[model samples]
Target: MKGRATGGLIVALLTLMLAACTVVDLDADGKPIMPKDPNAKPGYSNQTPQQIAESGWASRVQQPAEQQALSWADMETKSHTVKAGASESVFVRAGGVVTAFDNSNARERHLTMTINGKPVQVQIGPVLRSNAIRDAAGFRFDEFTNQVQYAQLTKALNRHAVKQLPAVDASWVGKPVQALLAVTMAPGKVDDVVAIQLQQGSP
Candidate 1:
């Protein structure tokens, strides 16, 4: 009888151990469901943008390729004839990498890319309509931008055929990139970049 009792106690201990090792899942109605695997990879949905930027996988992505020099003189020549009334779209094909992106303003975000080692701002937003007769001018990415303007710029950037690397903080610095810029020409003012298509390979 003593031996029989010891065996029953051992069985009870083993049952308790097994229970401790098991995981329990419940549905919204309190019904038991299968537990998920504890070893599965975690999802990024819960992570913030900052966290994603700092991830190990972020460093492994391919960088932009170097592109041929763009012709600013030619762009300036074309700018001379643009009539300022309604907004006119001028295609500017330039090749370069972003050197700086300024997000200091609460409303607008501005970036500068180097073409042939010359820094030029990537313009974002509406081009003003003027009636004065003046020489056509090359585009400029306006320095003063607000947060609302920055949002509009990002939306246009997203439409690019090639996915641009995130501009989080200064991650875009020194990264070679190219774009088909849609420049807006107005009288007496520098051309404004209203749209952009970021390219992957050389343009």
Candidate 2:
């Protein structure tokens, strides 16, 4: 009888351990329980990094939603060193990664570009569209996102294609920027772009 009792205790302990692992502490309605991260706070997504306490993953970590739409329109950009007769590139910083966006997308938002002190308006494209979430490994197939097929996935994800640039600058002539970047949650709206960044190099 003592041996049987010991076995039962062990089983109970094992069950408790398993329960702990499965406990996600979701809200009453099964939504993810948002933490105290300032970024997750209500209306934080629309605020700029400087305007708010912090931005990027730090904000997302505390937010209730697993995904957030980031936008940057009418963002004032810095000068870039573009090479003669080469493709100029710009980066969009999101979730800690500085990824290139399609030129068509940039043009749609009327993103301002300055090359060698000359302002130019251009669209951008993503050099790396999709990224694998480090923690999303080996979950079910539904959770898997193969970044390799980013082109097709992004094409489906972005509803509207390049439409129109409300503003355009012709000063970018004869100048090339090594790098440029911007971010936004709203598109086609006349608003200051958020989280603008740039780099200079030959590509």
Error of model 2, residue 53, in angstroms = 18
lDDT per residue as tens, model 2, 123-195: 3322223211111111122322344333333332222111111122333323333322322212222122222
TM-score of each: 0.39, 0.21
Query: Which segments of model 1 are wrong by more than 4 Å?
Result: 1-73, 83-87, 124-169, 186-189, 200-203
- Candidate 1 C-alpha error for residue 81, in Å: 2.0
| TM-score of model 2 (CA atoms) | 0.21
Overall lDDT per candidate, in order of appearance = 0.47, 0.31
Leading candidate by TM-score: 1
Top model number, lDDT: 1
Instruction: Write one digit per residue (lDDT tens) for candidate 1, span 72-171.
Output: 5565565566675654434456778888977666234556888766787764222212211111122122421344443343333323312332333467
* TM-score of candidate 1 versus the correct structure, residues matched by position: 0.39
- Model 2 has a clash total of 30
